[model samples]
Target: MFKKVLVANRGEIACRIMKSCQQLNVRTVAVYSTADKDAKFVKMADEAYCVGPAKAQESYLNREGILMAAVISHADAVHPGYGFLAEDALFARMCSQCGLTWLGPQADLISLMGDKAAARKFAASRGIAIIPGTFVLNDPDATERAALKIGFPLLIKASQGGGGKGIRIVTSPDDLNSQLKIAKQETSSAFGSTSIYLERVLKHARHIEVQIIGDQNGRILVLGDRDCTMQVRRQKIIEESPATFITDAQRRELIVTVHRLLDGVNYQGLGTVEFLFSDDRFYFLEMNTRLQVEHGVTETTTGLDIVMLQLQLASNESRLSRQIPSCDGVAIECRINLTAPTNNNQLSTFSFPEGIRVDTGYQSGDNVPSYYDALLVKVIVNGKNRLEAVTLMQKALANIKIDGVSTNLHDLQKILASSWYKKGVFAVETLDMRLEKHESFTG
Candidate 1:
């Protein structure tokens, strides 16, 4: 076990990782920007260091600053919590070269799975069901050819895309030319890579992802599945464990498929395999080579500490013969974002609800700046069943009150009370349609 670890990220996830490290008797070093001088994670950590200015380029995303912090702190390991440099292969390699343990997958796996096009091809070669897609297209003519082969309503997605960025949907040939150009430009700007591919967009598909943990010993355990279909603006707002739509048999099949895919690749550490469930079949979307933002649901349902497991795996500990953890109940998480209706600005105050688990990295009097992600807190609930979980989430959202900043709390409450969500009949576009219809209704 590592004696001290530096967290190379910010916000709730950084605080969450610090708490887990504390529980495991590990000292934590938090790296923060000048903007987050008094952030929750910094206060929680045993030691905190100011990396750079508020801009991400000079701060959170600055790899050299983070590495220097870890080195100066003499930390044994560095945990990149979810975003920033979490899945950066170069960061992973740097950690290895610096003789510090990277509490995630090896650089090789990160490099391999980070590329969507390469990942799709690897999955196909390993017999994993992959969505119909084309390889990376450098020329617009090749993109047109691939789009025609994949048919209309295809998604022009970035080869190295994540977080729903660098993706565009083309409904027909007329929209293809312009949409492809825009997608390529966005991909280049966001990821610094113009490499893009095509994939058949599954209309009304349920976004289901399997959480799996692997160790250096090649042991892989599928924790379960999460239903992330309740999304608005291509961002998942609510996520639940043990999808309401998939049957027990189907769930088992999905687990087996994930195991097969991992076994073929000899995958390691905590990773998420996302899939598009449509027409009673699962098509691989892409693999996230790091911990997911919605991993709290899985922890609530299974009572497992994923961060501890990741640390152990990074230390080259054996994990073979360990049985899959059992999930006692259903868990749901609502991402409370500090976003306004018309304009995006910093939040001045925040008020939360009681009798619910509110995992947050911000507090009252803290500024929810517009320079970073709008996520303020993650409210998680667990119940004996899905309905009970839904009701608990609704109550939690109702009690949450944040002044001086507009949030999706009211919208989330409406979603929980809707017929589609009540019956668990939701797709990716479900929230958008609901919001469009209820644009005037605040509650």
Candidate 2:
């Protein structure tokens, strides 16, 4: 076990990692930017270091600064909580060279899975079912040809980075070029990698992902599945575990597929294999090489501390191989944003409601800046079943309050109370329709 671990990120995830470190008796070192000088994670850690200015390029994303902090703090391992340098293969390699454990996958695994184009080829080679798509194109003519081959209503996605930042859906041929340009620009700006690929977009598909944890000894455990179908503009708003959409048979098949893929690649540490389920069939999407933002839902349902698992796995320990964690109950998570309802302006003051698992890294006096993600907190609830879990989450969201920021509280309340969502007959466009109806009614 590592004596000290350095968390190379900020906000809620950093705080989340710190909690696990505390329980494991591992000292934590938090690296923060000047903007986060008084952040909650910094206060919670045994020691803190200022990395750089508020801009992510000079701060949270600065590899040298973070490595220096880890060295100065004498941390034996670095746990990149998600986003930022979490999926950066170069950072993982640097940690290897520095003799510090990267509390995630090996650098080669990161490099292979991080690239959407490469991942598609790899999955296909291993006989994993993947959505029909084209290779990465740099020329405009080639891109148009590829788009036509994939047919209409396809998606253009970035080869690097997730979180739905650089994805565009084209309904027809006329819209392909414009969407491609926008996707490329966004991908380059967000991930510094403009490499893009195409995929056949399935209408009315449920976004299902299987969580897996592996150790150095090549033992892998599939925790369970999550249904992240409730999304707004490609961003997940609500996530639930043991995906209500899949049956026992389908769940078993999906788990087998995931296990085969992980075993084929000899994948290590914690990762997620995402799939788009339509017509009762699962099509492989890209894999996330690090912990997901919505991982709380799975943890609540499975009663597992994923952070500790990552730490143990990184240290080449395989204690969890003897028994797999079972799903005890249903769990749901609602991501509370820091934007206002009117202008979607960022908030400065914040407060959370009681009677729920409120995992947040921001305090009342902290400023919800536009420089980072808008997520303020993740509200998670566990129940004996799906309906009870939904009910508990509804009440939790209603009781929650945040001052000085506009959130989707009302929107979330409406979603939870809607007939479509209640009956689990919702698609990706469900939230769009709800928001449109709300706007029309308000107008």
Candidate 3:
């Protein structure tokens, strides 16, 4: 029942959040960087403010400027649409101190789950199966010892951030020290923390995650699951609901375990618990404290507005006791990313299939800014079965066209045509391998 809510992020997510706010009759305030002054989300908001310059550090992540905008706009709450300051515990606290409701989890829970290393340990302690990993690394010797203990083929990862950055894979000791140094520097630069950890790598695992929501009264609801195995450079490109690969028993176990973990902690709002599935076992990966980039697929399958649920949780009355909806169909989402050639871009003909749902940050003729993430749109499709969903997605992608900017539309079509993908045999590294093979053959 907020009169006005300010979205503290950019791109498709911001626009998506505004749609939900509009449906709920809540006025929206949009804070944008100079690079995004004329973006679609800004135009859609009831009030807009320029936070700062193009760089995220000075703009989207500017806590003071965002707080000032919220205060000046008289926003009753702030909904950080999934990145930048979404998981910043201190920023959440600052919003609370300024008498604005924070739309996600409480500050303490955010701080606890934000630390990757600590989260892994907490999951293990709570009886959630976790990949064999080490605590924070102190020195090269410590890294060497952890490597030997966990065996070769391990991952060196930043302990404070996600989004697939600050990660390095090493198969032997000779590469450990060099990779560790690089990871530390990258981690420090990206997350402002030098903490690192080690984990035994699952060579071929299906990346599965469960969608979970909790309320102030400690009720936890599992909104089904998604398979995010189609990734390039450790970033997910395609996400699908109902997983389609796991058995009924495995799905039941995953839901029960995730529910148990959330029940132990006083978790609130929307979150995702990721896992690596291999050899009929699931290993906890990490928890995302905010809404995921692929949440559209879940929404398609469940027919529920996750952002609306988050708002209801943040409301003072907390009247979110509605029963969870039954998931009916299979859903798929494709992320449309702007290639390097489209730095200064224009969309001449932006159109999608009639039956498909496309979430985008720009309209036709809008300049695609290079200041933020490369993702320009998400095309989500739903069907009665997986095969139908895949076919619908292929048809939808083929029909869609956005001129004056290069994208991965053709790449996605090729993937859908491949036998390996059709047989559901792809993994996290499948896209990179396929692209490499294609390049080598062409060369």
**Which residue runs of candidate 3 sit more than 4 Å off their true CA positions?**
316-324, 341-343, 439-443
lDDT of 3 by residue, 1-443 (tens): 89999999988999999998999899999999998988999999999999999999999999999999999999999998787999999999999999998888889888878898988888888898998889788877777887998988899999986667678889898888898888888888878899999999887889999988878765778887999999988989899997999998999999888976788577778899999998889999888888889998999999988888778776754565555567888999999898775567888878887988899988998988877788989999999999889889989989998888899887888777666777788778777776777742111
lDDT of 1 by residue, 1-443 (tens): 88999999998999999988998899999999987887889999999999999898899889899999999999999889887899899999998899898878789889888998898888888788888888788887887888898998888889989668678889999999888778878888888998988889887899999999888765788887899998877899999997878988888889888877888456777899999999999998889988889999999988888888787676755454467688878999999887663343445657776677788888877776566788888999998999999898888888777777777777778778876687787788877776778753222
**Cα TM-score of candidate 2:** 0.93
Best by TM-score: 3
Clashing pairs in 2: 339-406, 340-406
Model 3 clashes, total count? 0
Shift of residue 103 alpha carbon in model 2, Å? 0.4
Per-prediction TM-score, please?
0.95, 0.93, 0.96
How well does candidate 1 match the true structure in TM-score terms? 0.95
Q: Mind giving the per-residue lDDT tens digits that candidate 2 earns over 125-170?
A: 8788888887677888888888898898898989875566678889
If both were scored by TM-score, which would come out higher, candidate 1 or candidate 2?
1
Candidate 2: what lDDT?
0.84
